[model samples]
Target: MAGLVRWDGFSADPRRTEVAGVRASDGDRETAVEALREAYADGRLDRTEFDRRSQAALSATLLGEFAPLLQDLEAPAPAALSVRDEAVRRYRRETRDARNAVLTVGTMTTGIWGATSVFNGDVYFFWPIFPILGVGVGWLMQVVNRGQRIEHHERRIARRLGRRRDADREDDGDA
Candidate 1:
C-alpha cells in the first residue's frame, strides 16, 4: 500500500516535472550547440567545458537531457532586422533611386537637345520635354507608391498596437 500511492495530476518529484521521452530535433541540438559556442566565445565557458557541452548537446536524445547543458546560459537574441525597420530602409533606398533616375534622365535629355540645336544652328524645337515628361511620370508614380507603402506600414503598426492593448486588457481581467 505504501508503494501503491495514489498518483495525482501533479508529481512531487522535480525530475518528474520534466517531460520524459520527448526527443530533441536537429534544430534544437544545433541551437544548443550554437549557444555553447557563444558561451565559449563570451568567455563564460572554457574550451574544455564548451567541447563537453557541445558534445552532450549533439548526442542528446531527449529534450530534458539537453537542458542541463545550457541551463546557466541565456539564449542569444535573433540578429534579424525588424520588418518595419527593413521596410523603412527599403523606402529610403527607392526614394533615392527615383531621385537619381530623374536627375540622370533630365541631364541626358537636356544635353542631347542642346547639342542637336547647337549643331543645327537653330534653337527652335524643345523635344527634350517628351523624355522629361516620361521620366517625370515614372518618378511621380514612384512617389505615389512610396506614399502608399508608408501609409500601409503605419496602419499595420497601429493595428499591432491595438492588438497589444487588447491583450493587456485580457491579462488585466485574468489578474
Candidate 2:
C-alpha cells in the first residue's frame, strides 16, 4: 500500500526518494523530477514547460551535458606535477655528484699536499693553503648537503602529488 501511494504529491519519506542509494536531497535529480511531476499534476506547470525541461534533463548523458545547469561544478585542469619531480631528481643528482667530487678532490689533494707541506714547514704560505682548503671544502660540502636535503624534501612532495594524479587517472579510466 505504501509503495502504491497516491501520486498527488512527492513522498515525505526519505527511503521512497532514493537515487543510486543516495538519499534524494533537495536539488537531486529524482526529487526535482518528482516535484516537477507533482507541479504538473497540480496544474502548476503547463504541458509545454514541463515537457521541455524533462526532456533536457533526461537527454543529458554526461556531466558536461548538464554544464549550463551546474555551472558551479568545475572540473580540475591538467597540471604538470611530473615536472617538479624531474626537477627534484635532477637537483638531487647534481648535489650528490658535487658532494662526491668535493670529497674525492679533498682526500686526494690532502694526501699528496699534506706530505709535501709537512716536509716544508718553512714555507708559511704552503701551510695557509691547508686551512684555506679545509674551509673551502667544508663550505662546499655544506652547500651540497643542504641542497641535497632540500631536493629530497621536494621529491617527497612531488611523489605525493604524482600518486594522487595517478590515482585520479586510474579512477577516470575505470569510469
Candidate 3:
C-alpha cells in the first residue's frame, strides 16, 4: 500500500535505518555522554581531543544542539565576579565556623578535665602534658575534618567553574 501503515498487530517490525544510540531529547544527555566515553576508549580520540569534546558535550543541552533551538533558549550573561565573591565569602565563613566549633570543644574538654583533677587532689596528673595531648588530638581531628570539607567544597567549585568556562567559550564562539 502507498498510504501510511497503521499498526493493528502486536508483532514488532524493526526498521533498518535506525540510529541506534542517538536519542532526541534532554533525557539523552547521559546516553550521549556514555557514547562519547566509549568512543574515546575505542582509540577514536586522543586524550586532549577527547577531553575537549567530552567537555563540549557535557556543557551542551539537547536544546543547544541545533541553531534554531540555540536561538530560542539563549542564556543570560554570567555574573562571574559576583559568583566568585560569594563563593569566597562562603568558604571563609564555613572555615571560621569550623575553627570556632573545634576550638570551643577542645577548650571545654580541657577545662573540665583540669578542674576535675584539681578538685580531686590529683593535680599531679593536671600537669601540662596530658591536657596538651588531649587538645592536640582534638585539634588534629578537627583540622582533618575541615580539610575534607574544604576539599569537597573545592571540587564543587571547580566543577561549577569548569562548566561556566565552557559556557563562556560557547558564548564567545557564537558571537
Candidate 4:
C-alpha cells in the first residue's frame, strides 16, 4: 500500500522535509503559542483543543512544526497590501472630491457670469475665467502630485497600523 498520508499543519504536501528538518528556536515556539492563544480567544478552538495545541506549540522543536498549527487558522494579512489598498482608496476619494468641487464651482461661476452679462446687455469680459483657472490649477497640482500624496497617505496608514499593532501586542502580552 502507498504510504499513509496525514493532514500536516502547514499543508497536504509532504515535500516540506527541507524546511521541516530545520531546528526551531524558543522565539518561534512562543510565536506559535501566541497564535494558538489568539485562535482560542477568537473562539476558533474549543478549550480542550486549544489546550492541546498550546502545549504542542510550547514543546515544538522544529520550525516546520509551527506550520501545522497555523494551517487551520486564518492569519493576519500582509501589512503592505492593506496599506497600499487604503492609500489607493484615499487617493481616489480625494481626487474625486476635488474634481467634483472644481466642476461645481466652475458651473456656478459660469452661470453667474451669464446672468450678469444678460443684466448688463453685453458680454461681461469673461470674469469667470479667474476662479475657474485658480480651481483648475489647484486640481492640476493635486493630480500631478498623486504619487507623492499616495506615499504620504500610505505612511499615515502604516503609522496608524503600527500603533494598533503595538496595542495588540500589549493586549496579547496581558492575555
Q: Each prediction's Cα lDDT score?
A: 0.64, 0.49, 0.48, 0.71
lDDT of 3 at 125: 49
Q: In TM-score terms, which candidate is top?
A: 4
Could you tell me which residue pairs clash in candidate 4? 9-68, 10-68
- Output the number of the lDDT-best candidate: 4
Worst 10 residues of 3 by lDDT: 1-10
lDDT of 2 by residue, 1-175 (tens): 1221112222233223232233333334443454445445445567897686556546544322332332222222234335555456445554656666666766776666777777876433444456556656755765657756666757755774576577669769999
Give all TM-scores, in the order shown. 0.39, 0.27, 0.31, 0.52
List model 4 lDDT by residue over 1-175, tens digit each: 2111122222222236677867776766665676676566546789999898888878877767766666677643444357888788778767876887889889999999999999999987888888988888878877999998899989976885676577669769999
- Winner on TM-score between 2 and 3 is 3
Candidate order (lDDT): 4, 1, 2, 3
Clashing pairs in 3: none
Clashes of each: 0, 0, 0, 2
> Taking the tens digit of each residue's C-alpha lDDT, what string does model 1 give over 54-136?
99879987766665676576533442446576456556655766777878888998999899889999995788788778877
TM-score of 2: 0.27
